[model samples]
Target: MSISSRSDKKGGFRRVRFIILAISVFYLAFLQSSVMTFNTAYVVLSNETSSPLFNQYQLGATAALLNMNQFDWSPTYLPLALHRFPLDGLQRSFTFAASFAGGLLGTFPMLYVLKHVGAHVTMSIVGIASCILCALTPVTIAASFELFVGFLAAPIFPVIGTVIEDWAPMEEKGLFVAILSAHVELDTLFTPPVGSLIAEKVNWPTVFYVQALVCAFFTVGWMYFYRDDPGEHFMITRDEVDMIHRGKTKDHLMSPPYRAIFTSLSIWAVFISAIGTIFVGQFMDVFSPQYFTSVLGYSPTITGTLTIIPTIALLPLKAIAGIASDKITRISELAKLRIFNSLACFLGAAFFVVIILVPPSTNSAAATALIMMPFILLAFLSGGFHKAAVMISRQHSSFVYSIVHIFSMLALICSTFTIPLLTPEETFEQWRIVFIIFIAVLTISNIFFIIFVKAEPAEWAHVSNTNEFVQLTEEPRPKHQLRQ
Candidate 1:
């Protein structure tokens, strides 16, 4: 081919690759939302039905004896019964606990799979398996069985780090990581209302069926288009491959320095802060709907609607934070991360206090606004630490991410069990205690990150004179500048 022809082809291929990767990121976002939505809906349904089920039958005994489809299972059953069944907070908490525990159990195996098979394959498998598991949700006779299936689907979110490390350019790393991290908020933005509407209008089973179909579609697209490295992609031209590899010295495929990683205080800072952040977030995920309906006297639809405000506020704020972290070249990367991460947590803690001060009997709009402001502040503030994680361990970003994920999952599990224990009566007073605990956790974790987290690559991650490891200190030039 002529030089001009080759250049045109490479440009075209790069665009296609970019488009494919964008779609994949969004799909992963959707999947994350779907899982959370499924769990949220399950908790809502369990709360809605618990009293009626308990009133009518010995549910613990009946649950054991019944088959998957025996308990009046149908797409329409849940929607129709939403008004009929009464709320039970304890039951909801237990269901959340079970799902989180299942996720915790699934984390290690997911790490192993991601290491051996690579992210694209692992994610594709996870997508299909999650879809099947979601389809089985309505008929899940036992909570234990539901937990087991949830465990199977648990690896979806952590793998995004691998995808970003593989596809995103070094200069744009912060932006891409921020965008990918925002998937959680993106999921939050759409899933709650959509899931709630489906549960209310169509029925709960239909929700899972719909989610399954969406998952299958995306999974197929991902399997066909995603390549772990640019060189492996058939459509990628030589120029595009060179462009992708240009600033790179690191062998991203190398085995991680396990001891160095485990002993790193910076990693531990990220880990603990993630646990705190995720714990608070998961608490809201599982309980916020219940709180809206039970304590605040809002209907289910209104509760779902109210939650969207915080999610909407998060999107732009998160994008700004991500962009700022990338653009502020004067500051040390570690300093930038510390500032953003600590500020986000501290602000989030302040908002927790605001939430606690607002009486449950306060105007619903005011309450919603108070709850949302903190999330908005937090949305912009919290993701820099995640960007730092990638900076410190480019080759092992996924592995490092999995470690953070495990702690986050553990936090979710702890919240599931402890929230119920603290809020046994499900009163405003009980919830106040929960908020106080979150505030303390967030504050302490933020302090720890400020004190210990470093943005520089760990010493063990560096290549010796004899090796070909990528140098950590090299600044990545923009792609356009590089070719010029």
Candidate 2:
């Protein structure tokens, strides 16, 4: 093909890839967020009459930070609020933990299924299962169904990682990884406010029903439109497929070296960073709706609107950072990862610390900005440890990514249960302690990431055959600029 012709074909396929990624990522993320936002109504649900989905789901803790339940211990302590119990941080954490139980189960299956069934098939099966689970959540087994719904999330992104690794041009691989990751925040953008609206206007059950319908629409659209191989896609031209292959392709996947993966400090860095990311990320994402409604005294509708706005701002910011990371390739990918990860971790901790000190406020915009700034800073992870995992693992990227998700799952469990225990009164003083602990976790995790993070592929990421696939291309640099 002529140079101009190849260029044209390349641009066309890149556009197609982006569009497909967007459709697939947004829908899948939306599905996962739909599962998560069930907790948005946790306080409301728990306070209502007991059921399998609500009070029955919360069997243990009764005291919340400053609620009247605290007086059972102290005679002199003044109650901050008069709220009923069984919905304290511990209960909330356990409910959050249920999803991880499914994640842990699905991770091993993901490896097996992708090795055999293909990405499109795995994603389709997961999507359908999620929708079914969401639909079934109205029954007395809602919590169980919700747990099953979590299984859908486990393999979905790993499959997406494999597909993106196959199609994204070499120069744009990191950009694609980061861009696709926007789904993490994207789902949050929708679920909090939208879920709250449905829960308020209709009922909590209606929220799941709406999610089921949306999930079905996206799932079917993906099943119809996506093909396992670029060459097999009917909508794509042969030139487009060729262009994708010509740019970057992973024609074979190898069995990952488990010992290397487990022993590598670089891999541990990514996993550890994931723990901090999920802990701090969910600290705001999962619990904020409840916090705004309970502690800050906002209605659920207002809380939803306020909570999602930061994420809306974060999406474009994350994309911009991704593009910038891809465009500014001279710095070395390892350096870039450290810089971005540090900014995310330290700045997020800084924001959280500031919020702990922030006096109570009623002004919606200003208060929301202060509250959500830490969340907005999470945009850096796309350029940081997230992209690093992909770069470092390559052919075994799915397993590495799955490990990151597993770390995130474990961190979320700790974060979920930890906060409630620290701030049972939900008082500002108790919140200070919570923020301090989170900040410490963030700082310590960043330290390890900066110390051990790697950008080049690990020894275990070798291809099955000598397929001559392209390694990630960084912009040309001086010989000394390369790290060992």
Candidate 3:
């Protein structure tokens, strides 16, 4: 049967599926959290145990400092002190960057599958594969390779967006986006301790196995219950259907123009603002458990459990910030909204820097508290900044978001590679230096947003109501177009 015919005939069933998908995505978010948290904890634990280099940290450190001049920094050959590849450090760093880069590159294929095979089909395939990979991979070292799997999974968001757009009206994208953030809360809050315990006792591999099990359940449930759009689902009540259609009819006709949105100053601000937050966020995601355990001398279990605090804070903040963004839609108020949010980034980064400055003589509790403060504040600021981005993103959301993600990924790569190279060792001093540099980068990025980003009152509707949205829709650039 034709696609449209399928959609037409399955209206009742589709509504049912929509309700299921909505719930499933939220659950999937939690699963994503678990997978990632486990991956991080596993890597740290695995390396501490299996990697001879970490095992030999004290001997290597004493030897290096005592015979400082004799050590080789050259990349041409492996260093003699390391048991694995001298480039093990380099490999680890690059792997982190590569996973993100791989994900970004993989977005194209997922996007293609979404358009051709359909969103549900594409997500199902990717989700199930990711679960299996997590379950079967050997060692955290091998499992790290699954980071690419997660990267490929990134495009699922846009696919979800497409379906959500069809189900929700245009005016309510902000709400839809906020709803999506709830999944983030689940992931961020629940995974840390659970993953830590799994890593602490059973080792890291079980984390992946657990994730696989959850994904399996979700996959079966999604296939059995979810549909592509509300129009395709049977479970939606008449009232819900009327509400959804009303939304589409009222704002549906006003799809924004790509060029206008692409060129808008507000779009740039929204994009950069997001990049600022992500740079710090990635640091927390990738390095937190290690930083807590290795640097702060906390046990793995404590480190894992503590990581959830910031994410927990984000749940309420996300809701409030989203509502605030809607209220601050006027151009006159844009400056305050953006600045306030950006200030949060600035302060969060600043607090992180402060943690580095604290003397080593300070109590461990004090140090941990300092470190946790920045994370909490960053989470709070993230809500505001992200909400603002969504309110403005409506004009050119797809491309703008893609660009923002691209830059964020670029930052991720830079931080991953440069920090390790500059430090060359995992000493507390080296961490201090890296933290200082991160503070500088985060501050500068946010400052750039403040100086350049502008707010426009009618930015979202300009393309859709005028000829812009339709024109761009008709003649989208190949790279920007959804592939079939």
Candidate 4:
């Protein structure tokens, strides 16, 4: 039977164990984006004096130092340590940037840990630490815990790399990666509405506690449910394992090919592609709360409700894109990657441009419709670099995708710094500049991807045999494996 026929048959999902594994990843992803950014931004700006309308606090004093015009730099610019960062947006953004920097610095070491120690252990450590961090976040003004969490969470994509290589069937790689990565995003989708409701009906501090409990549950379950090797999974059947391993071999490299991977034009394409994707992602997930509240002038509940619309629309679209990429077997893997990658970037670029033109108005629904389109097009990425990262590098995928994670962290840091600085007033015109910057970055990124991306394994990685389950070893690049 053809690959398309098998894809139609629901290749990976037919197995029960893969279903459980996928669910675990979904919960793991849920922890990725904190609800505090969305639910707390409004509260931070609240004060009795300067902004009475936004003041939701019990205390008279604790209003944000960040104002309508620029950062209200108070006191002397001392190099001395302050116990608490100002309860202001600019300070908040700086700490957030620092956390991403922590992640950036921690990426390669975390990558090494995930490659050697196993994802199950790394994830469990994250879950445990996050529980402590989430609980303390409500009280601590210093973002030290968040920085540590960022370091641990830095391994997420590499973990996905492990999942893709371990369980995903060769032909069905796109489908497996798309669904799994989207599952990881399930948190970002639900956080807006759920976090909003929790903040409104209950309280914001409770949000942290709830997430802590979630962390505890995830930690225990992950330790029990996930395994470094699928064969170690007590519930997984031999037949399903065989199916996943079809046209794939299980081989471990003592060390990654650093020189080849870094030098390869394709890997650079993945890195560039990630920066583009992450710029949009950071904007949508982290900065959009500020956009909706400060620029669009929406309430916390309204902002959450509005954001969920685009996110809710993302899952099915991503699923469709993944399925389509798999079923369309007529196209080469490289062709499919280029087509789908271009589709994602171009579609997103178009939507972003539309949003800037329309701006926000009294017609809330229209404004929402305009804003949501760009975020919705994030689904098209399932067929884009997400899969390309795995296809191009194969077994070295964990290491390769770590490059994505590294660049993604840097993008987060840059966005944290740049977006806050750019939109000091948080006006629509200021935001238009930010969105336009993303459009240009995304377009240029796609051009690089089109030029350099390859779906086949790189010649240097040394596992080019087309036979089923052929083992790989470290060796020099071959003439056949060379990019044509």
lDDT of each: 0.69, 0.70, 0.56, 0.69
Candidate 3 deviant stretches above 4 angstroms: 1-98, 139-148, 167-175, 182-185, 188-192, 203-205, 245-264, 293-295, 324-336, 353-364, 380-385, 422-436, 451-484
Q: Model 3 compared with the native: what TM-score?
A: 0.69
Q: Model 4: which residue pairs collide?
A: none
Residue 282 displacement (Å), model 2:
1.1
Model 3 whole-model lDDT (C-alpha atoms): 0.56
Each model's TM-score, in the order given?
Answer: 0.80, 0.80, 0.69, 0.80
Give the least accurate 10-residue stretch of model 4, judged by summed lDDT: 1-10
Is 3 or 4 the stronger prediction by lDDT? 4
lDDT value, candidate 1, whole model: 0.69
Q: Candidate 3 on 161-262: residue-level lDDT in tens? A: 554445545444444555554665566654655666666566555666676677677777767666655544645543344445442322432334567776
Query: Which residue runs does candidate 1 get wrong by more than 4 Å?
Result: 1-9, 13-17, 37-96, 235-240, 294-297, 355-364, 381-383, 425-428, 463-484
Arranged by lDDT, best first = 2, 4, 1, 3
- Which scores better on TM-score, 2 or 3? 2
Encode model 4's per-residue lDDT on 79-158: one tens digit a residue.
21111123567666656565676677778898877877887788778778777777777665455666776776677777
Clashes of each: 2, 6, 20, 0
lDDT of 1 by residue, 409-460 (tens): 7787778678878987788888899889989998998898888887776776
Given candidate 2, what's the lDDT at residue 224?
A: 87
Q: What is model 1's C-alpha RMSD?
A: 6.9
